[model samples]
Target: MTQVKLANNQWGYISAVIDEASNEVVSLNVSNHANKQQLATTLSNLQATIPKESMPILHSDQGWQY
Candidate 1:
C-alpha cells in the first residue's frame, strides 16, 4: 500500500482493485477528495478493464470512500 500526502498533510482515501485469483493488480485509483463520482468512475473503469467473459470481482475496504 502507498500513501499520498499534500502540503505535509495526509490526503483522502486511495482505492485499488486486485485480482484475487492471480494476485495481480487489475486497476488502481486515487483521489484527494473521494466521492461518488470518483468511485463510480473508478469502478466503471475497473469493469471495463476486466474481460467481459470473466467473472472478475472487485474488493474494497468498508469505508465511506466506497
Candidate 2:
C-alpha cells in the first residue's frame, strides 16, 4: 500500500497485487481510504483474472487491511 498527496492537499491510497513469477501487476485499486473494503476490492479484481484451479500464495506485511 502507498499514500499519495493530491491537489488541494487531498490524499489517495493505492493497493496492488503483483504476480511474482511474471513480475507483473495483476490487480490494482485506488481510493481515498485505505480500509478493509479497499483491500477486498483489490483481491476481488485479482480473482477475476486468475484461473479457478490456481491457488496463488499471497504475501502481505500483515497490516490491518490484511
Candidate 3:
C-alpha cells in the first residue's frame, strides 16, 4: 500500500495486488482512509474480478491495512 497526494492537498491510499511472476497488476483499490476493513473490501473486489479456480496467493508487507 502507498499514500498518494492528489490535487488541492487531497490524499488517499492506494492498495494493489500484483502478480509477481508476470509483474502484472491483478487488482487495485483506493480509499481515503487506511484500515483493515478497507483492505478486506479491496481483496473482496479482487476475488470478484478473478476466477475462483485461478485464485492466487496474496502477499503484503506489514502495513496496518494489510
Q: lDDT of all predictions, in order shown?
A: 0.69, 0.92, 0.81
Candidate number that wins on lDDT, 1 or 3: 3
Runs in model 1 lying further than 4 Å from the true structure? 1-7, 59-61
TM-score-superior candidate, 2 or 3: 2
Q: What number of clashing residue pairs does each candidate have, in the order they appear?
A: 0, 0, 0
What CA RMSD would you report for each candidate?
Answer: 2.8, 1.3, 1.8
Rank the candidate models, highest TM-score first.
2, 3, 1
Error of 2 at 33 (Å): 0.7
Best by TM-score: 2
Error of 3 at 53 (Å): 2.5
Full-model lDDT, candidate 2: 0.92
Cα TM-score per model: 0.68, 0.88, 0.78
Query: What TM-score number comes out for model 2?
Result: 0.88
Better of 1 and 3 by TM-score: 3
Please provide, for model 1 over 41-63, each residue's C-alpha lDDT reduced to its tens digit, 9 standing for 90 to 100.
67887888877787754556757
